[model samples]
Target: MPRLGLNPDHLALAGAELADESGFEAVTISRVARRVGVQPASLYSHVDGSADLRDRVAMLVLGEMADAATSAIAGRSGRDALGAFADSYRDYAHRHPGRYEASHRRTSPSPRTVDEGRRHSTLSAALLRGYAVPEPEHVHAIRLLGSTIHGFVTLEFTGGFAHSAPAAEVSWDRIVDALDHLLRTWPTSSTDV
Candidate 1:
């Protein structure tokens, strides 16, 4: 029987906290169960294994990020909207490095995972709408924005910019400005290849 108060969500939440505290790699079934003061076997009732636990953490992180982005971009548009969206991602990563790392974990697809994953894409598409990017080029724009934010956050979180001159914040602001400019002046293909 499942523990009286333990469920998948609870386990996942605890695992997420663990990830935030000790790094995503620390979020194992045994570790979570330990955090919950239960035997490792007790977690079987809530999660299939570590992978499932990690997936749940990923879903959780994605949902939190989507919420942050949504709230940040509300009542905003153009460069303002773009800056809010970009800052939302950077802020979330800074606030929750472990959860941010878990968000990048590989996972097998499921309905829940698929839906959660779409939230980011949907939010990004909405942000791009303000720039009036061509429908056919939306995919490229989304990829560009996603890669830029992800790349910056990953490098920043990993201390890639720690030893550099000029604080990371300066570069971040400049990059966001550049992105806004790029989106505003997105090039159109003159010839259909």
Candidate 2:
């Protein structure tokens, strides 16, 4: 019989917490088992293996990030939407580093990837919508936003800019502001994304 109160979701949540404290690379079945006060073998009943657990963690993180992005950007549009969306993501990365890392590592989501993922993508795409980007340019805009946000977050996590001026928060705000301006003035192009 399965453990009534213990399952993939619980394990993933606990694992995410562990990731935040230690780092995403530190998350593993053994470490999570230790945190949950269960035998390593016991976790096998809930998760196929470390990979499966990681996938669950990624899904959970994505859901959370999607929610945060959606909530923060409500009643907003264009540059307003862009900054709000960026703030939501930056806040999530700061608060849940582990979950944020998990979110980036692609996991073949449990069927909802297409649906749930669309909503998440729309957060940025909607922001881009205000910019009047041409057909193909819109795609580039999306990739640009992803790269900028991820690159900044990754660097901040690794202490890349911890010793710099303007602080990480300030840099994030400025980056979003710049992206807003760039998108608004984006040139029409047919460069395939």
Output the number of the TM-score-best candidate.
1
| TM-scores of all predicted structures | 0.96, 0.90
Q: Per-residue error at 183 for model 2, in Å?
A: 0.8
Measured with C-alpha atoms, the lDDT of residue 34 in candidate 1 is 94
TM-score of the candidate numbered 1? 0.96
122-144, model 1: which lDDT tens digit per residue? 99899989998887778889999
Which residue pairs show backbone clashes in model 1? none
TM-score of 2: 0.90
For residues 1-193, could you state the per-residue lDDT of candidate 2 as single tens digits?
Answer: 6666899889999989998999878789999999999889999999999888888788888889999988888888887888888878888998988779888887775676666677777777777767777756666788899899889988998999988798888887888888888887887755554
Q: How accurate is candidate 1 locally (lDDT)?
A: 0.92
Q: Which 10-residue window in model 2 sums to the lowest lDDT?
A: 184-193
Q: After TM-score superposition, what is the CA distance of residue 155 in candidate 2 from its true location, in Å?
A: 1.3
